[model samples]
Target: MTKFGKIIRRLQGDESGAALVEVAITIPLVLLLSAGVFEFSNVLNTRLLLEAGVEDAARYMARCSGDWDTCKGFAQNLAANGAVSSGSARVAGWLPGTVEITKISKDATDTATGVQLYLSTKATVDVVDVSTDYTYQDLGFMSYLGFSNFTLSVSHQERVIGW
Candidate 1:
């Protein structure tokens, strides 16, 4: 055999670097999987927190008797900080301005039958929808993976009871 071919065969038969090669391949994959798990858990936790805040705000607004502007403002505060007034945000990087409060009024009567559309027999039903999108901040994992930051959105809807 040629000198280079003989050297190649000898190196391939050697097992000295086998464990090193395996470890070199395994460690990075393990780290990547671990990082993915951590990031997914973090995102899930943030989404749950945001959902709770949105539900609270939507429920509060549904039962609120205040005017439109003030109620929306308080709802924003509640969603972001879990309080009507100023407080710390529930999630990091979450701001009150990120919350969007929308009010939707559905016709109470069915157009075809001219009867109440809702089971509650109301002429009009109001719904409060609270929504927000949060930008997740990873520990440079996504950037290392050549990906941009991802956003998570949460929303809650409640029917106005006027109670």
Candidate 2:
């Protein structure tokens, strides 16, 4: 037989299960890649939550620095408040069921005429609470793959408006 003929015969006589074997080996790798995507998305979600919570707390504190009760309430509202109520609302679902807002200080900056009170707030997020109550549709894949919740802390300082 010619060289071309021999090559054609070799190709036709290839093992029947070659494709099946390749697929089997690749399946696990595909699944792992998908899992990694899910995990990375979860991490991004966590970061966004941390950012939003910090912004809310800071804005609230900056707005009302003179009144202690109002400021704490505002800070608490920021810490957990409706921050979880708006936007993606996905990560918000993971927002700690109960968040604590601690005041870093209560002092005014600048002169008496145009005083800007500086206040700091911190929020402690509970991972367990997130798992139990988070509503991220049917996104249980990552959580199943050991993407459990963890405490996230956020801090910010804001200048209170008015004297």
Candidate 3:
């Protein structure tokens, strides 16, 4: 056989570097998937924390009838506590101009002595609306993939009870 034919045969039979080539191609894809999973988990955890905080504040407001200022203070405290518990170090703080509280009232009739009478009175309901924005600092890998810092906004509302 000619030298060229022998060289071709040897090259075709050589499988020594096949595993290395496959690993080189798949390693980066595995790493990218792992990073994505990690980032998604972080986002999910932060969202859950925010939801818990909001729910707690709402329940507090519902149980205790208070003025707008008092409810606002409670919401702020809950938001800060949530940030600490979420484990995201990059969260700067809750965004301003997002917290809101509104009061509502409605009039209704009452029945007494087998007669319906207009009470001419209104019942007041206090609604607490809380919204918080949190910033997440992406990992270097994510940044390289064109992802930047993003904000997650969470909001909740509750009506005052036992008022």
Q: Considering every candidate listed, which one attains the maximal lDDT?
A: 1
Task: Give the top-scoring candidate (TM-score).
Answer: 1
| Model 3 lDDT tens row, 5-98 | 9999989979999999999999999998998999888778777876776676666656655665665666556555543133332234543234
List residue ranges in candidate 1 displaced over 4 A. Answer: 1-20, 109-117
Give the higher-TM-score candidate: 1 or 3. Answer: 1
* lDDT value, residue 99 of candidate 1: 92
Candidate 2: stretches off by over 4 Å: 1-13, 83-149
lDDT of 1 by residue, 38-102 (tens): 87787788889999999999998998998988888998898889899988889988998899999
Off by over 4 Å in 3: 1-5, 82-125
Query: Candidate 2 clashing pairs?
Result: 62-160
| Model 2: how far residue 160 lies from native, Å | 3.4
lDDT on C-alpha atoms for all candidate structures: 0.87, 0.53, 0.61
